[model samples]
Target: MPEHSYLGLASAMHRLTELVIRAAMSELSFPSLSGRASCGLDAACGNGDHSIWLAQALLPEGQVTGLDICREGLLQARKASAKAGLADKLAYIQGDLHSLPFRDRAFDWAWCADCLWPGPKSQGFLGMDPMPVLEELVRVVRPGGLIAILFWSSQRLLPGHPYLEARLNATRAACYPFQEGGSFLDHILSAPVWLHQAGLEKIRGQTFVADLHTAVDGQAGDDLAACFQMLWGRAMPELSEADKAQFERLCHKSSPDFIANRPGYYGFITYTLFFGLVTSRPR
Candidate 1:
């Protein structure tokens, strides 16, 4: 497997956590039962930011276990868990989503964000379809367990918005087969309906919409540019040297104002978080 360094990717992922938090806060309602005293699970927890956040929110006696397919990501998550002094209450694991490697009904709350997309050819990570992974998440949680998931939505991000659009286009140009048809809605939103198929009840699905805001002359703008580069910029590497150079020149020319953080460069990027919850009843 080609080791993709997510160090840069992690930063963008953390920035997007705000979207996930808002989704969890609004879409999914906690049971009258205490979340703090409850145990939780984070599926496909890349770097574990969501897990750590949940731990802080549900602290006092709650524990959160984060699982990821990538070992490097898991290691980073473990470090974060420890740094937060949550090592004792938090756990990180390297595991396949198809086979969760944990017992059934193991948790009360489950959370996962933006992980249903097909893996890259170089990574050979998870496949395009998330059905198997979905089954596992449903299986691991006990009856009455609260399950919250956010999958990719429609093309709300700009050409400047990173990751999904670029990756889909690149893979298609390279002639790769993707199951979800390159749209976040096609992939992630399908989960709510899938949960119903899996016999999950009280299935509620909603789109959490938010706009990305960046100041013209601040760290957020710098971070946004860096993120766009890390996610979509890398796809240009596959271009021929001359083509890459011309493309870079074109990009620079077209987005001079945006790159320079001009006042008008600030624009709203809209995204919808597809969140679903299921009562832990037996199917």
Candidate 2:
């Protein structure tokens, strides 16, 4: 089975993305959530950091609900929310993406990060597929509400991005079936067109790229270690010993080149984040 655990490096990467997202939001004039207006939804809010950010953005009146299928991730999100003292403004649910638990036209907007990927490693789960979940996120939000989905960009266009390259390498080696694991770029570069096919409209999208910097006063060591653990740990359970060993070696060796500024070295990697607005029309 594919690993479901969120790596610390992934979390750090996510936090960095959050920073860029907030900056982009400010640049885009995304209205701040007031205590009395503008509710929000975070689709597939793994570990709740993004959801909590939404909830915090709401302040006193703008409430938010986060939904995800992973009970463990949800639990972590809940804890984080509570710790941040935003529990009252935020709520969470474990639900199917094909059929969101919210009422029709419930939310003003929805945001999901890395949620629309293919189904979980386990069978018999909804939203293990990207297309339907995309449809559902668009469906639940009121017309004109915005949708933001973030994912790793393709390596070819952003070759300096080590994280994206590493992730793609590990995933490909793990034998992910889709041409791109149903990537964000695949959906975003094609924007409202893809959403149009999913029965969404007025789709406008913008892409932002941020470098995933690991070097922070020697924190790179732990960051790389956690990334390796997240990659190999999740894979080892299902892979053959030979494959597992090879993967281990790969994970172990990947950090050094990036760390020491050796020949053929690349700096912090880039991640692509995409945001769009859902329209009233089907296309």
Candidate 3:
């Protein structure tokens, strides 16, 4: 990822997803994280928004260390922390999730987002097994500490307006190969099983739905539409000519025609969180 890349249109969609995750976090009951001067790790921290959130939430004397494989992401994360006046509370480092650079039991908790899916690709994809990475997270988090993973539960749009739903189906089909098991939903739904195999206990999961109605004409709605447009652009090579044209007709925000006729357009995406206690290291 590029420096300051997380501020772009595509990232806005990611931020929306995070918003849903934050709401879920607020509702879920977890052990008191604010009492002691505890430390936590934000694995695959990306631009570090979650790191900042973790630091603020775990504060008083608590700290959050953010680790990512992207150097530019870490740089941007550091800049963001400085901008937020959280440089002292948050630390950014560049490292691989499969082999974290921390000593055993370095953190009281570990949190990851959307980066654990297995796919065909190497650098970006999680490969055929995510156990190595989960084990690494467990290894660094102290026994009895919590591990949380938030990810998109499904790419398919839930039942909605027929036009928008069809477009979403096309979008998923175009992006099929890039996704794990031809669907991100499949991989995300299996998270509990993966966590269990990684030796985590007390596993729990939650799903949050974010609805974007373009007719509302808000910044968030516009941004969500733009994200779909971006996906369409990227998937153009895989899409048939007819599919491409239809996608553009429905999702292209830059089109003046689309701007003028924007009404009754709605989109829905779901995010899921899987959390548990790190009872022991992987056997």
Best by TM-score, which number? 3
Each candidate: RMSD to true structure?
5.2, 5.7, 3.8
**Deviating ranges (above 4 Å) for candidate 2:** 1-3, 7-12, 24-29, 32-36, 58-60, 119-129, 154-171, 174-177, 180-192, 212-217, 228-266, 281-283
Flag regions of model 3 displaced more than 4 Å: 1-10, 27-37, 121-123, 155-186, 213-217, 234-242, 257-265, 280-283
TM-score of each: 0.73, 0.70, 0.82
Backbone clashes, each candidate? 3, 4, 0
User: Candidate 3's error at 93, in angstroms?
Assistant: 1.0
Local accuracy by lDDT, each model = 0.61, 0.58, 0.70
lDDT per residue for candidate 1 within 1-283, as digits (tens), equals 1125455467664574465565554445443344447787888788888778777767468778898878878888898888989898799888877899989878776786766555553565466556677778877877767776664343233435354344434643332224435655344446766666656666766654444555433655655655445434655655666645544543342465444254444433333443344454446
How large an RMSD does model 2 have?
5.7
lDDT tens per residue, model 3, 1-283: 1123334543576655666766765543333743567788889888788787777666467788999888877888999899999999898888888889999999988889867766544345656577888999998988878899987665443233456445555564334434534544335578999899888989999888877665664675567556665444555666667766766665556756453145675556788889998885544
- Sort the predicted structures by TM-score, highest score first: 3, 1, 2
Winning candidate number (lDDT)? 3
Residue 29 lDDT in model 1? Answer: 44
lDDT of model 2 at residue 236? 61
